[model samples]
Target: MLDISKLERRWLKYKIKKILPYTLLITTVTILGFTIPFVLSNRHSSKAMIPLKKDAIKVKAPNTENDEGAMVLEPSMHFIESMDTPSTPITNTPTSSTKPAPTPKHSIAPIASLPTPTPAIAQTQATKAPQPIVKGKLTSIKRDDTAFDIHEIEDRFKDTSNPNLGVYIAKYHYDHGNYSEAYNYALKTNSINNSIDDSWLIFAKALVKLGKEEQAKKTLQLYISNSNSQAAKNYLDTLDKGGSK
Candidate 1:
């Protein structure tokens, strides 16, 4: 037999608004008092106070290096000369005409007709077929394209000491389906260094593409550990289902 009280309890607890009002926040000290997961001492023992050993706390203050100088931005004026200049002129001249006199005709040999000239040999031969333009993988990207090589981007991050370049490069590789390389490089580019949740997402996507199902599952689980992973967690559900869309 089903319990009657359980249904009533579930019904009464349906409104989250009702429960939210009861969850009042308490101080950290109060929280620490009751939340003793481990009881090291007997409850009946009177307080045994020992002098707290004062450890020398070394405070490492950030170097107060004054920024080099205030950026001196030059003010500029963009003067655009409008092309529609109004005043212009059009010129046309017509001159008067004069009449001339007539000339006499000759008889000669009318029976003799002019012979047609023989055609010349063809000047140009058929041009050979132009070679097809074939494209291969590029090794090193330049500043011009800002892309081409995965290593180039990695080197950029190395040169600039900017970890963000790794995120960009990893995303570029993952988006292009170079998942093996993406996953390989992602190991070096720590997810914590990039946008935490987003990097993990890209890593999961790369892992999925690389056919590392178990690793991808674990990666997604790590993502859901965050407080703000509602949407990511929903996506994780889809990934868990192996439902490729």
Candidate 2:
């Protein structure tokens, strides 16, 4: 009976050992199945709670030039400060070039503006007659007479080569403020006889009156060098001092 009991115990021990291994394996499988699902769910919940990193906020730089889609930027503090500051006022000083040019003391009058020589003077000089060699003073017009016939003198000048007539005409024209005619007549007289003091005087004076002072001075200088006239010297001195006559 003791041997039968021992054999029964051994059989029981073997069965327990085999059943214990299967029981531990089933318990491990069941625990792993439940824990795996729980861990997966917890991981998903933690990921959702962590707030997935959102796309970074993006901003483009502003463009100053013409761009309808571009945002307008406000002026900076420095620009605003510059606009508020007062600038220095510009002062224009009159330079030498800005000043009005000085008017010449002896300005030549335009031909149109020049005084009429005489009523018949223009008509008589219009058709120049042939000049002939003749002598003697022009007794037709007196030196003291203010209402002298200029036409007659012009006619006489055209008809004769008398230098005295030229002198008379030049002197008459000068006295009447007809400097152009005076210059012409004086030039003609000088051409005939340069030694005539009255002709030289009239020519020089006419030159100055007609705004030819330099030419007048040169002419006088030449005459003085040749003739050594005291009167011509005086006239040159007067011209240097800006005296017309």
Candidate 3:
């Protein structure tokens, strides 16, 4: 027995020192392994690894674009952003995104025989055309002395078998600019009707117009729970902006 505890302490220290260098080396190797692949993938792509044949990867001459997929449509980010905003114009002049001049336009000229646009006289037809009608039906409820009593309207709507009578009345009230009454009716009707989102929205619109901003916000949040229309989104954004001057 050559002082066993001393030997054990020395052995542990030696093992720890040896293990620390290898552990650091392993960690460095793993970090490099992940980072190298991530950086390469981001900065440059490996086109050679792509399975497209040479024929499929055809390139057009300089100034010409490959138009095989020219008809394919892409959604624009600018269009999406503009949907919710009044667009301030981008002032930067764009680089020419066009390819080489189209061959049909390049060779064609006023000297060559060409078809003329139809004259206005030729385009006009001598027939009466029907006017466009919007989808909503106008309720006879008037803004004059003959408007429906709010209580009677609410009571009648409470019991009416017709599902849309309440909505029709809400729209009628909204059209008349009776915002407080409209909000009241919509709020009560929505509570009675069990999550009718449209009613809640009419309430929200009225609240916004009436300058009850917090209530309008809550109403919109409730409505947005059930709808994704751009109209709803715009209304909610209007509420967020504290309404227009």
Candidate 4:
């Protein structure tokens, strides 16, 4: 029995010696697994407690020098609080319409025509009553032989004091084969202005045309004596020879 007991003790000692190294290795690995993660978690928590700048936020960055999934702290962006009210989104879609708007049109107004003003001489002639001699003389004068219309000249004739108008009237009558009217107008011209030689010559010629040759010569002689007019002298010599004007 003593021999058997000694053998059993030796075998048990041998088994314990062989298993002890593997037991220590498994125990150390398990402890390190738990302790290393706890240490890493504490390190990260310390980094989170570090002072941060205003408006700054912390973010996790990969740590290349450590384990594959390990993370470290870094200031990545700004932080803002969420608004209490949400903003409405804006869309750029255009609206549709059935018809287009019409363009505007401009309207023009017509201008009114004004009446022509009458001349001062025309107004004066309108106010005067027509004399019978003037009416008869206007009717008898040949309108075709006159340079201007008879009515136009008659308008200027209203200003009797104008000797130029009287002379023009006398010349118009004489050129148109109206001897009686020529005599009247020519005499009227001389009455207004005796300096007009045309009126004197027309007066003498009108007398000759009216069958008063003696009277025509006597009038020419009288005019020549007063004015020393060569024209009047020539006319008087023609009348003396019984020549018609």
Candidate 5:
């Protein structure tokens, strides 16, 4: 009544259906895990064994003659062979050929000899009339006689009441080494004409020459205020240094 054959066949079909799904899943997982890593490892090993192709560019090393310790890289044979070679030799020729001109030679003529003259002829030639030497009279120039007397000028100026004449007399006396006379005349000129800078200057100079340094310095300083006179300033500087004018 149990029908064991049919029951056994149903049990076998149920087990095959359940186990086939598990077997297919396990086979798929195993194949994925083992085949993927093997394929990746084989690809990596093939790449490592193969050589890489590089560009045929030539690299030149820097010149190291100036740098004694510099490292120089040697060029490879492939790099040398890749460089362009000359197909023909170059020749340079001038378009025109020039020849140098020859130098010219100058011919010199021989000098002629003169005949000797007789002693009588030589004496006659030497004795040919000597020129007369005329002596000129020496004229004496009297410079002192031509000069006008100061006494005469003083007499003439006594009649003329000219301040400039006084100034001129003062300068003339000062130039002639008469300091007392120059001082008197200069004082009179400056009193008559206060604007006469030359009179003040001559007065100061006469005072300095007469050994009156203090009076001369005072007179020059007073004159310099209105005139800004360089000579007066220089004279004052000389006095300050205790130097003679």
Candidate 6:
């Protein structure tokens, strides 16, 4: 019985040695199968999480020598940052309509026309002829056509019929340096026709030459106010400057 038990024990030991190696190998294979699939799935997931660029290209940095004289390439963060980002579409917002300001209206009144003067009033004004204010010997003399000679011309100037002829005679005498005769004739002409600018100018000039500067200046200023004559202004200037003729 003891010999049989020893044989059985030896056989059982041999079987355990052989089966243990096979059991360890099968357990390791099973564990590896499950771990390998899990690791592979994790790797795929991590690869999916990393962003991929369609236009990405490998860029080599400039070779730099290390202390061991070996070339090394360094990754550039600036180059990666400089890459273009995806553009977003721009949307335009709608605006509210604005109202225009109202224009102001102005009221305008029509101007009335002035009434025209009657013919009777005009005729009365025409009849009131200007008379000579200066009292001279020529103012009393009467014109005679029968005695209408050069000597009688000064006397004829007294007549109110034609004052322009008297003014011409006055200017002629003034041109010939006969200031006294010119003064008398100019006074007569002005008395007959005070509206004549030349008659007033010649009268003023003759008055200035005959040492009547104040009278000449007064007459010139009157004539200038009435006619606005340039010749009268010039003569007035000469009188102001103490100049004669």
Best by lDDT: 2
Q: Using alpha carbons, what is the TM-score of model 5? A: 0.40
Hey, what RMSD does candidate 4 come out at? Answer: 54.7
Question: How many clashing residue pairs are found in candidate 2?
Answer: 0
Question: Model 2 compared with the native: what TM-score?
Answer: 0.40
Worst 10 residues of 1 by lDDT: 88-97
- Residue pairs with clashing backbones, model 1: none
In candidate 4, the residue pairs with backbone N, CA or C atoms under 3 Å apart (3 or more residues apart, or in different chains) clash, namely none
Off by over 4 Å in 3: 1-155, 161-163, 226-230, 242-245
Best-to-worst order by lDDT is: 2, 5, 6, 4, 3, 1
Task: State the lDDT of candidate 1 residue by residue for 89-159, as single tens digits.
Answer: 00000011121111101211010110111111000011112223334532221111224344555666566
TM-scores of all predicted structures: 0.37, 0.40, 0.34, 0.39, 0.40, 0.36
Q: Candidate 3 has which clashing residue pairs, if any? A: none
lDDT by residue for model 3 (140-228), tens? 21111124243444565666522244543564465456777767666666765635445665676677668776877776776666665
Each model's C-alpha lDDT?
Answer: 0.41, 0.58, 0.47, 0.51, 0.54, 0.52
- Model 5 lDDT per residue over 78-128, tens place: 211211111100001011113211111111000010012323223333433
Quote the positional error of residue 67 for candidate 3 in Å.
76
Tens digits of per-residue lDDT, candidate 4, 142-183, equal: 112123344454455554345555554554465456789879
Candidate 2 residue-wise lDDT, 191-240, digit = tens = 97787666787788888888888898999999999988766777777678
Error of 5 at 230 (Å): 3.8
